[model samples]
Target: MSATELAGTAPAEANRIGAIETRGIEPVPADERTGGPRQLFWVWFAANISILGLPLGATLVALRGMNIWQALLVAALGSFGSFALVGLISVAGKWGGAPSMTLSRAVFGPRGNHGPTVVSWLSRVGWETVNTTTAAYALLALISIIFGVGANSVLTVISLLVFVALTLVVSGLGHATLVWIQQWATYLFGALNILVGAFLITKVNWDAVAHAPAAPVSVVVAGIGVIAAGTGIGWANAGADMARYQHRHVPGRRIVAAASVGAGVPLFLLIGLGGLLSAGDGSLASASDPVSAIQVMLPSWMAVPYLLAAFGGLLLSNNLSVYSAGLTMITLGVRARRVVAVGLDIVLTLAGGIYFMLIAGDFYGPFITFISLLAVPITAWVAVFLADMLFRRHYDPRGLMDTGATSVYWYRGGFRWSAVLPWVAGIVVGLLFTTASTSATDVWFSGPLADSWMGSNGLGWVVAFVVAGGLYLLFGATTARRLGGTSSPDPTTRPGARTDGEPAAVRP
Candidate 1:
């Protein structure tokens, strides 16, 4: 369908203002926004209710030796904590009415902001690539089950292309269409998950649940860290992308709840299910590759529909990732339409996913690498980011939108050392405690915390937040952030920006 047709089909209430979502990086004008916090809940809730979450939880069960309850507890703790950050950053959505990365320009400065933007872009693409790959894996497995043609190298390639095609079409249609699609997709996912969850419940072995491997205290702590990093810190960079188009008067608390509960519930549930399935004596329990075990669960009749929903659901998941990726690209001074930028993401996804699928073995290593590597730096960045919001109590959305001489963010050739220096420090500190392995391990700088108290793999979240936030306070992120530009009142606190504005990406 044409983009016009897609937009036309959306509910009138959603598009009543007739805001053309063409301006990718600009602050949204007040008149253009048209939603309350309720929309945010559905957007994130639907996105999280996918098969993508299973591997994270399943790994915790089989690899970390966590019992079902322990895995669920860790998963819930992480889900609650990380998603809170997602909610905190989501406040920028209503404040700036622009992409979250663009709003970040205020903190990082224009040129310096590009660093995080690129990092955000790469990280989203990495996760999206993994999402697509998992969908491809499941879809191919279904094809194998039905046709009796084994899922092979050729089918894997085919499934990926099919997945990529779906994401491009949905995201290419842009925001309003994407939102509309997610609402219905979420309903479908919820229905399907209920069926799957019930099926899994009947198959659980309570004996194994009782006798599952006992985890060390360090392992339990690390597991909580891993789950927290994966679920909580996971949403840090993308919060504003989801909520930016919310009506300005929507209470901050509501937006926070919308983003937090939206993603957190599904993550905790799905991961818990994976852990439960792994711990049981069901068909999945003895499977050599637990991540691939979801394939065998469906009855013959439900098989195709489940696969269809799973693949369709992947597009729902990838849409926002690609959408934010495009916005991040635009924020980094890439000049392109959001649709075109998403097209670029498709190209990269194609290359990256294919390359990884070919040479990758034991997804255990890659998944940990992907999540842990990105988790810490982002935690540090968000730490400083949240602290900036708290201390400054204001951000001029104009500075993010303007990107010109008078803008307060235009400092030191568009680089703010206050933010970036501390962020870099946080990254190094995070990595100091980070260990490189297929599974979570400790490295040189694992610190006395790990030496005496717990294992080091998941400690970056706390360390980064504290170090980066403290450094920013010392660097005067609040009092004096720029050398070349004079400070002003928070742009968002003021009723308006000096210039007429246009709509930008909403947080999801």
Candidate 2:
């Protein structure tokens, strides 16, 4: 259907807007965007590989005692879970030509949006810190190998500084530069992983791999599925940012087509390879750097390539986190130009690196365990949003003021009781569940019957998502507004809405 038809507008009106935006028919014109299937395909492919592929591989080595094969399967499934939100964002982008946060106003209301928006911003910050530190450590390891300064503190410091400098420089280039970085990193990491995989496969004792104390194949498969589900989770949240570029030009199917080819296929290959290799090596429980396994597996002559490839692969992964972090800051109204945001990011990155250097002792498991645990609440938020978008027709945000209860807080008068009560309930329930799950891991499950039922971070997310989404639905449809929602237009989208008077994709 045509844009006007989809939006429930008349043909004449749609034609007029199309002419204005695509041609020179109207005053205050916008530039016509170029590219269709190919650009989108490359962007999606580059994004997936750089953002999730290698990191998921590395993470699998560290978590779940996954051999390469098992790790890849789990990580791939995790990616599926993550992409659930991406599917919805793609539709919103095609229909509204708005960024994800802007579209969020419809559900949260203008002022009420601070909840999710702030969470996104802060979450990205933490991710950035983690990425920067990890990349620096990887690079430092490579430098140590080359210079014969194995485990030198000074080298580590120097690598940390370099990461800070590079991230800040790239931040000034804004989205376009970041996109370029992702593409370049994707190619680089792909080459590296291939080399690593080849070396490791050659070195493997097939008999040892076959005999490793095998978890039930089904358990391993299910674990692989779990990891895979979480792999592309961030892509869903960030899809609108990328899709905004496409929606202006390409058709919807083309966009979805690009996502499937670009993200889905390559990711499966990379993570699956990593998992298989990890499964073959029974040392997954203690392995932090999956690439290191290949190092031993490879001949001495191959060591240089393996080390360089490892550094490049980790660096590429870090670039995604930095880019995403910067974008999240922009959405949060960081008030600085792209360069300024980069500068702040550099400072944060260095601080994080230093913190890691000081705090990292003999154990890595505790840190990842903590991060995974803390990530539950955020994942819960994603799950709830995904549920509403997929199952309910009433939650559509294509047109009208999408800001439901959030609108009441930001633009309209009066508190949205529906949101407040549900939010509180979700938070309390989420906290209780997280605590219970942590205790359960320590073998402490004694609690009230209901509390016992709520154990596990995964379960906590389920509770929070259901409660929050249910509340939003109730408030949006029933009560004061009735099922139709308040017809009164939201002020956020009004001509009076705030703007920095700058384009969305501005460079520094």
Candidate 3:
């Protein structure tokens, strides 16, 4: 087939459908892959980081205090490129039959995979915490607006618990459940935001929006990095994992692109606008509380609809939070049925969710910090995985399966010590930078390097990528020459090979 023909027709989407038509084993069923580009778009749309705005916006507001335009610019910069990274990751699902976590085996090694997977698990758990906390806050705000009780009242606790329980119940169903929830939530929230935002625009002063202060470059850069990291990490790790199931009739790359934009951009705008609106007025304190902001934005007549819509969005957020948690658990080699794995995820997620809801005071800082910290290793793994595929031709041609678990990755118990050193160095540098920026005057370095490491994790990601790649090449070269001498075959140019079902082990 011509490359374009090969790229377009019988593309990644077709490979997935063929597997399903032939009754192949996969985590999510083929019927679940039924969405067209539009559906994929909405899925992406709903996936955009919604509550993230409250925390992220709050940080900027506290630091440099950006106004609406400035906030939007930061969001745009951070949010746009994220989807592309995710789209690249989604290629694995389409080409290889693995889920996001499963794909880690290639770069992380079978035994080494546990590090990335654990990092992924923690990241998802942190997300669950943020969702639960946001839901709790939103519910309390709504209850006060509707019935006049205080936000921290006993009644609010009961309401939050009930919602958490419900989230847990629904989260147990896996992909089928997630897709359905994604559709309904996106429609409900999208409509509500439009309706309320329109009313608010008419009622409120547009001058205030224009008068808002511009965000500082440093703050804007940090904000963008935070948003980009939040939006892209999982998607980058698993976009293909979800996209792989697209029906043969669906266009592959288009679905990926649509899904990315749908999920990342809308959420960015939604949260960014919320911050803008809240900041202009004294409601800045409740910037994270979408329902309250919604009610304030609209007239009494529109309150019910806005609340209903916001509630749906909240549910949708929890659904994804819990669903992705299920994905991480399933990546474990324990081999439970898909349904069972999801059930486990729901239970575990609920416990963690509730704990965070009750205890986490400043949910935003920890939410961003935990995920950003965990992302370091996963990003390293991804950088290495892509490099291996591009230059080393690691996969067997006939099956397209990455059978390098033994020859390529099996070095040092499948954990490259070389890669480990770089990872440690990156973390240490990133952490030191973070500490120096936050406490340089007290802890010494307060000048150039402090700013250099001001938003240390952001720089850490790039450092980790370069360091890991360099270490992999250095080690891979020596190992390659010693094991087989001369040269190693390229993966992309060769015919595919079948798998022996020996997925890279993820020993933690």
What lDDT score belongs to each candidate, Candidate 1 first? Answer: 0.71, 0.49, 0.55
- Taking the tens digit of each residue's C-alpha lDDT, what string does model 2 give over 1-508? 3222322221222222112112110111113233255554555665555322543554455444545555545555555544544655665555444445544544444454456656665555555565555556567656666776776677778878877676665544444455566566667766766766676666545664455454446555545433533444444555654454443546666676666666666677666555545554545435443344445556767777666655554454455455555545544555544345556766776776677765665223433443444444455445444433443222123222222322222433322334444555665565555432223255222223234544422344445656766765665455425423432223223333332221112110
lDDT of 2 at 91: 53
> Alpha-carbon error at 346 in model 1, in Å?
0.8
Per-residue lDDT tens digits of candidate 3, residues 232-340?
A: 7545655654565565456556765775677656756665665555555645433434445446656667776656556656667666666555556655544454445
Count of clashing pairs, candidate 3:
23
Which candidate ranks first by lDDT, i.e. highest?
1
In each prediction, how many residue pairs overlap at the backbone (N, C-alpha, C within less than 3 A)?
Answer: 13, 45, 23
Q: Is candidate 1 or candidate 2 better by TM-score?
A: 1
lDDT score, candidate 2: 0.49
TM-score leaderboard ranking: 1, 3, 2
Candidate 1 segments whose C-alpha is farther than 4 A from its true place: 1-20, 213-218, 280-291, 297-302, 392-394, 404-406, 439-455, 477-508
